[model samples]
Target: MEIADMFSTTTIPFSGITLEQVVLAVIIAVIGLIAVKVIASAFTEMLGRTSRLSALIIELLVRFFSILLYVILVLIVLATLGFDVSSVVLGLSAVIGLILGFGLQDTVTNLASGVWVAAFRPLDKGEYVEVNGISGTVTSVGILATELLKPDNTYITIPNSQVWGSAVINSTRMDTRRLEVKVGVAYDSDLTLAIRVATDLMKNDERVLPSPEPVVVVTELADSSVNLSLRAWTKTADLWGAQWDLNREIVNAFADAGIAIPFPQMDVHLDGTH
Candidate 1:
């Protein structure tokens, strides 16, 4: 007998599946799955070998093939079982649709949002940004959630809706930032000396930018102290560093020049009745 005639559904004399036939079908399914695995692996390897290709592109391609491989193998196995799968799935499509609507609506929504984000790129990976109230570096943008690496080394997986809905503040976009520190002096202190020392420190500091020149202005005359505003510019990358260093410089500079950076002191004068 020819091989096709033996396995043909119409020509086969077998009434029902035998132990041998069941074993053979299982073996065929296993081999089919293995073949799919091999093909997908080869495809991924080929894509990976391409020059200067984006990692995301390669990753998406590989994932697609992997998913396709599994699906194809599943269909082949179902076909081997002598069942008409298309008719069955078509009949059940309505029930499947309802199940997906109830159970996966939010998941599907996020996936749509993620696609929008990927296309628009409101946030790129490894960039620092403040989304909503959480400030962190974007670690990964995904279908359902965007992962962020927090300042304290914690990982936050926020949903795509939250990311797209809120305002995003990109702090690292600027090259330099302004540092405003408040200093006060007693009314008796020499105003000229105080301004000289603050401005001198600002000009001399290497981290502080000299373009705008630092403004050492007596901003206000308070009840107890004359408020001096020390406004300086520095590289945005060095903002916190310059802030900590500049305060110490101001104190020492003022003291060395006999200019007292004052503490609030209230004077009470008793009436002559005493």
Candidate 2:
């Protein structure tokens, strides 16, 4: 038998569909996937340039359209392979409905929660938030899950249902944040001078906002030390930096001013009689 004859006679095992038809279907699928990818990228870039829509909406739209394109591609492939596309779709719909009815309640819940998340705009992409006790920057809000990038660069995917059900703390949503620094000084230290020094430190820092006016107050008088709380407001972006710098500055300032920050200590009493 000639090579061409062998090629022409070969049929997919058990099925009447020929090898040539399978190859064509495979080609169509590959091309469709590539096209879908390209279109999705273009769509994402286009939406990304717009300021009217939030990042969460952009991600949801891109994900939805990509899935839709892939579904259409699958139907096309089935049609090309001589399968009844309409019947396949109807069968798929029935199968999906059955699956949802059985044990896919969580999936449905996640999808519904995703819709609520998008609608309510609780947390958006690029915002740092704590959702359900997990703190991270939101990378994407998808149909079923919300992706986050942690401070340590670790990635987290929380189900949308959990995210929506729990409280979400958005740290970056506000323009300004109040930073509180607590330092304990020796009980003998002058409380008035300590407050003044701490207040001066905050006032000198350029990151600290002048509007609210930083205040230092004696919060507690412990057995070993008097605790001072320095409260200052700064731009949200500058909060961490201002906090770190103020802490270091306060330590040095106390040292320069002869203010002793006391650690836990106990004087041992030895019985002379023993």
Q: Per-prediction RMSD in angstroms? A: 6.4, 3.3
Question: Candidate 2 residues 178-241, lDDT tens each?
Answer: 9999999998888788889999999999999998999998889787888889999999999999
lDDT by residue (76-110, candidate 1, tens digit) is 66656665779656756778788778897777777
Q: What is the C-alpha lDDT of each candidate?
A: 0.77, 0.91
Best by lDDT: 2
Clashing pairs in 1: none
Alpha-carbon error at 191 in model 2, in Å? 1.6
* CA deviation > 4 Å runs, candidate 1: 1-96, 103-105, 217-224, 264-274
* Top TM-score prediction, candidate number: 2
